[model samples]
Target: MTPEEITRTSTTYNLQSWSKQKGLNPIPVKGGEGIYFWDHSGKKYADMSSQLVNLNLGHGNRAIIDAIKDQAEKYCYISPSYGSEPRAELAKMLVELMPDNIGKVFFTNAGADANENAIKMARMYTGRYKVFSRYRSYHGSTFGAGNLTGEPRRYPLEPGIPGFVKFFDPYIYREPIEFASEEAASAYYVAKLREQVCYEGSDKVAAIVMETITGSNGIIIPPKGYLEGVRKICDDYGIMMICDEVMAGFGRTGKMFGFQNWNIKPDLVSFAKGVTCGYVQLGGVAVSKKIAAFFDDNVLSCGLTYSGHPLACAAGIACVKYYTEHKVLDNVNKVGKTLGEILEAMKKKHECVGDVRYIGLFAAVELVKNRKTKEPLVPYGKDPDGVMKGLVGKLAQKGFMTYSHENMILVAPPLIITEEQLREEMKKLDEVLGEVKA
Candidate 1:
């Protein structure tokens, strides 16, 4: 179909997520290759946010495409009860890729359900009810995962599930306290968390869930000893540590998983996005040996119709192979360093840039009306004037596609992106930032 026809059909017949239905003129993507995708009108866009930070291997990956095709030719569907070759292989690959403590996998269709199953497993295994997650985090939007979420997006799920609890992140930039060092800040936050757990009755808390690097909510990297402190707290009590790696897994952070960057071993790790690089939807929870052993006699209550789907597993296997074969982590480290440098420079050059936080290719550029006071470009939980939207639109006009959350702009590009391509794409961001009025 022509671009106009495609847009018309989609706008008329389809419902877009997180948006009003009317006046929707969505782009008609014809094709994509490497770090770029083009519309039907031949306007190419650099996928700066990696299309919601999931397209890690980037567009038109032949290996992933061919793997999906191969699986389709053999067989497309298989019940999870029956063992399938691709499913078994991918599960083994995932186990091997995860930390030593992680011993088994429970597959799901996407991150939301992966998290949902993880929560159930945590509750069952610990025989406790309450689950704690930070206020700045985004797990997913499904009912359970939405409650697991702590941001404004979770408001629709109000009067939420009883056991889900919220806490503050170590968002030092916005924090009122002036700490002597990161260690001091970590101590303060960790102490507060432990105290909160005590007040809530630690024995009743099933798990302490956290995004290893806090994606979408400003990429708020934890200060030194914060994760270790959390780990210790989880150990002190029998509470499980669940790291949501949906947005930070698979070499996005120049490590296999985001938790690895902090050298912490979470009891349950929920992952998706990069495993299949959006080639096919797949997500899973990697449970530690202890959690796996818990289900030896007790019944594992979680089930999904599409769990361990063979085609998605096939795509996952090829995607994992491509990561190692192509030295994707090496590229992430190399280009990510360049990205950090560019973001730092932009922070210095742009008056609106209040802070720039990054790890590997994952990064956020926060906008503020006043750098001294750090007044956000838009108010918290309210973007009534569409200020952030307008700024993102400016970036889009320059062919640099990314999304904004509140006052921050996410800058995550595909893991396979080259340094030259990164520099070029980031130049567009630099230009757009230059245009923004403080």
Candidate 2:
């Protein structure tokens, strides 16, 4: 199709074709494979956002396509309440891949529902009403999950479901305890969290939820021992630990889950995005056996119609098989090292870059108006309607795609992206950053 045809279709059906922005639009993708897509205009753009940070396996994997087709032909849309072969098999495999004591899976068609369900599970397990999440974190967009979110994106969703409380993030660059030792910073934040819990009445707190590495929030990698400290606090307070691994799981972090980097285990790990590598829609809550057993004796009171859809199960099974056989996790680790070095070099060259953080294949560059003062390039989402909106466009015009949110740029390409490809993309990004100003 021509650009005019694509634009016409977009205009007729998608009134807000670009995520609620007045003039924003998207390229009409004809097809995708590996890490790039060709638009209706016959222009190719690297899918740097992984199409909402899914597509961990890239696109057009024959194995996933075949599995999806085969499953649809055999059986499709069997109610999730009924257990089918694919669903049962997928559950078994998921448990095997997860950490010890996490043996139950609750499926969903998307990330928001997964988190919402996970939150419900946490509350049910603890029989407490309050949840604690961070200011820089995003759980999901649904009312329940949005309330659990920390950023301004959740503002519209408020007054959010009651009992969810927010806290400051452990951003070392814009550190709350600046000039302090890393160990001291961790201890201080832990103490502050403890105080917050007490202020809220720890007994009334159901869970302490967090994005393992705070995705879409500048990739804030907390100081070491931070998660372990949280774990200990939860253990002491009898609060359930819920980690939203929606954007940080399934080989995206080289390990199976982002929390694994700290070697800390959460009571519930809500996941989506990379599970089926965006081959088919799938998301779910991976619960500890203790929490799973709670529902065994009592009603869980949470489920969705399309939970564990057969096609999604088939796709998930195939996706995991591909990751194991092709060693995608290993590739992420290998390429992650290279990407890490490149990003550090970028920070050195670009003073506007306040911080660089990465884990496995996931990475982000935080932009600042003044590096010494650590002032954000602009307030989040209040872009002031100028070249700020074109930062991403500038990268795109240079034949690369990157995701910009707030004042940070997500450099997360597909896990399958190579060092050479990353270098090329980074070069384009550097050129664009040089031209951008606060």
lDDT winner: 1
Question: In candidate 2, what are the lDDT values of residues 1-438, reduced to their tens digit?
Answer: 577777767866776722665555667678888888877667888877787788888879899999999999998889877769888998889889888979899899888899889888888889899999999988888888888888888888877777889888788777645645777778888889999999999999999999988888778887887898899999999999998889988888889888888868899989888888877889999999999888999999987888999999999999889889998889899999988998898888888888888988788888898887788887766778644567887888877777777888897888888878777777888888777663
Residue-level lDDT tens digits of model 1 in 222-242 = 999999999999999999999
C-alpha-based local distance difference test score of model 2: 0.85
lDDT of each: 0.93, 0.85
- For model 2, what is the error of residue 222's alpha carbon versus the real structure, in angstroms, after optimal superposition? 1.9
In the order shown, the candidates' Cα RMSDs to the true structure are 0.8, 1.6
Q: C-alpha displacement of 158 in model 2, angstroms?
A: 1.5
TM-score list, all predictions: 0.99, 0.96
- The weakest ten consecutive residues by lDDT in model 1 span 18-27
Q: What residue runs in model 1 are displaced by over 4 Å at the alpha carbon?
A: none
